[model samples]
Every structure is written in structure tokens, then in C-alpha cells.
Target: MATGNKEIVRRALEDSWQDPGVFDELISSDYVGYDPALPEPIRGPQGAKDNFKQYSDAFEGAHITVKDQIAEGDAVATRWEGRGRHTGELMGIPPTGMEIVVEGLNLTRLRDGNIIEEWSNWDTLGMLQQIGAIPSATAAQTR
Candidate 1:
């Protein structure tokens, strides 16, 4: 069960970025997601699809790579890296055409092979800086 749970999370992290439909299969109906980057918690499979859409719409050719995964009982932890070129609007900021790479970790709880809940922490500030939505530390200090 532990190994299978890890595989489930690995697929979710890698596949869901490009194909939000994957959430329909991997995320449970009661699924909820917590991310500091989000203004509100993500609820249900559709919420997951919308969350991924926000990023996919902003970053063209976006891809996620699962670096590592660990599972114990019904909980899975995954480390992942995402890469893309900012070719579309994001959070009202027009595209900067910058290539960005961001790393994050996700802790997921599964029930009956579907994701029940997940908590994610990622390099949101770094991504913002890369796309010029936020100034970099060096730029801020030099100003």
C-alpha cells in the first residue's frame, strides 16, 4: 500500500500539471488542498483543475518533474520541480517571456487510492521575481 501510494502521488505531481483531467481520477471528491500561494483553500477535484489551470495558462509548455517520493501508511510526501516559459498573463501581470524553474514539496494524504488532502510549499517569491512581477533582492537592495 505504501509503494502504491507513492506512485499515485508521483503521477499526480507530474501528470496533473499538464493535464488537469488527471485530478478527476487521482483526487477524491472530498479533496482539499492548502497552499500559501492560494487566497483560499482548493476544494474538490474541480478546484484542483482550476488551480492547475491558473499556472498552465500563464506558463506555456509547463512541466513538472517528480524528484523524490516517500510514503508511510496513507501519507505521501513528494519533492518536485517545475519549469516553463511565461508566455501568457499571470495574476494580471502580462507575460515577461522569462523561463522559470521552481521547486516545491507536497504532502498528500490518500484514501482508497485517491488524494483526500494535500499541503504544498513552493518557491512562490522566486517565481514572482523571475517573471518580474516582484523585484529581486539584489534589485531591491541596490535601489
Candidate 2:
């Protein structure tokens, strides 16, 4: 990764959750997230912080460890792992105090030393299924 991109990732990951300043340093004022879960992309650094707070509240201390980073031009692809214990509501589901180890990738597009846009792919269904928050097939397929 380029020095600036790595710096951005470091601030966003290694510090963001613990320190809000990370957002100030690495996120754009007009940021956008292409997450299907959100109807529209977050429009700024504060918006990004807002989204993180909601999810972070659900899984306190949850964090991502980048397994690999592929940087190409203005984009960076990161493969990471997230580990946390359910301690608050998430997606209308109450906490079960279960621990989740989820792995996924996040691809970000940066410009002017800040994240302008992002796309993420993660195991949502698998995670809910693992935590018993959603039903999974057992014994045989349902009709």
C-alpha cells in the first residue's frame, strides 16, 4: 500500500473505533459507502462515524485485522478478519452474548488522501446463522 493509503487505513482501523479523530484525518467530507445495507451512502466523515457507532455498539471491541492489501492506482482491496462478542442489538436482533469471528474484504477508493468511496463484501448470512440469530437447515432441507 502507498504510504498515505496505509496511513489512512491505520488511522481508520487501529484508532477510529477508539478515537473519533481517525475519521477526521482519513475520511472525506463527501464520503460515500456502497454498502447494500444502507439505502444511500454516508455523505461525510461524520456520517461514516455514525455508521460505525451503530455497529460498534452492537459488538464492543470488535476489530478487523487486514490479512492482505492490494493497492492499485486509486483503489485498495483489503482482506480482513473481524472478531467480537455480541453485547448489544444488531439489525433488530437482541444480543446473545455470542462471539463472532467474521472474515471479509473491503475495497476503498481514495483521493486527496481521504476515502471518497468504498465497497465491502462480508459474510452477513453466515454470521447470523452461526450466532443462532437466524435459522439454518438441520437434518434436511425445508419444503
Candidate 3:
């Protein structure tokens, strides 16, 4: 069960970006996702699709790599790294054409082989710095 649950989460992270349809298969209708970068909680599989779309729209050829995963009972925690070229506007920051790397962790809860809930925490500030939307700490200190 643990291994299966981990695979479910792995697929969600690795496959969802490329194929939105994966959400319909792996996410429950009642699925809810919490992410620090989001202004509100994402509800249902459609919400997940929309959330991923936002990033995909902003980053061309975006890909998420699952770095580690641990499962216990009905819960799976996954650590991942995402990389892409900033080819479009994101969070109001225009395209910089810079390649960016961001790491995050997602804690997913599954029921009957489908994800029912998830919580994500990622390096939003670091990403902004990499894109020049916000200055890095070193730059701020030097100024």
C-alpha cells in the first residue's frame, strides 16, 4: 500500500505537468490542495489542473523531478525539484528567459488509490530572485 501510494504521488508530480488528464485518473473529485504560493486552496482535480497550467504557461518546457518520496499508511511525502526557462509572465513578472530551478515538498493524502488532499511548500522567493523579480539577499546587503 505504501509503495503504491508513493507511486501515485510520483505520477502526480512527474506526469501531471505534461498531461493534465493525469489529474482525472489520480485525483479524487473531493481533492483539495494547499500551497504557499497560492492565494487560496485549490479544490478538486480541475483546480489542480488550473494550478499546473499557471506554471506551465509561465515556464516553457517545465519539468518536475521527484527527488525523494516516503509513504506511511495513507500519506505520502514527496520532495521534488522543478526546472524551466522563464519564457512567459509569472506572477506579474515578465519573461526573463532565464533558466530557473526550484525545490519543493508535497505531502499527499490518498484514499482508495487516488489523491484526496495535498500540501505544498516551495522556494517561491528563491525563484523570484533567480528571475530578477526580487533581488537576492546578497544584492540587497551590498546596496
Global CA lDDT computed for model 1: 0.93
- 2 against 3, candidate with superior lDDT: 3
Q: In candidate 2, what are the lDDT values of residues 1-143, reduced to their tens digit?
A: 47668667656765776787788789888888777667887778888888888778998678877788878888888887888888999888898888898877788889988988888788887678767786767612663
- Residues 1-143 of candidate 1: C-alpha lDDT, one tens digit per residue: 99999988988888887577889999999999999999899999999898888899999999999998888999999999999999999989999999999999999999999999999999999999999998999999999
Best-to-worst order by TM-score is: 3, 1, 2
C-alpha local distance difference test of each model: 0.93, 0.79, 0.94
- State in Å the error of residue 110, model 3: 0.1
Across 1-143, the per-residue lDDT of candidate 3 in tens digits comes to 99999999999899987788999999999999998877899999899898888889999999999999999999999999999999999878899999999999999999999999999999999999999999999999999
- Number of backbone clashes in candidate 2: 0
Which clashing pairs does model 2 show? none
Q: Which pairs, if any, clash in model 3?
A: none
Q: After superposition, how far is residue 131 of candidate 2 from its true place, in Å?
A: 2.6
Candidate 1, position 47, lDDT: 94
For model 2, give the RMSD to the true fold. 2.2
Q: Measured by TM-score, how close is model 1 to the native structure?
A: 0.97
Worst 10 residues of 1 by lDDT: 12-21
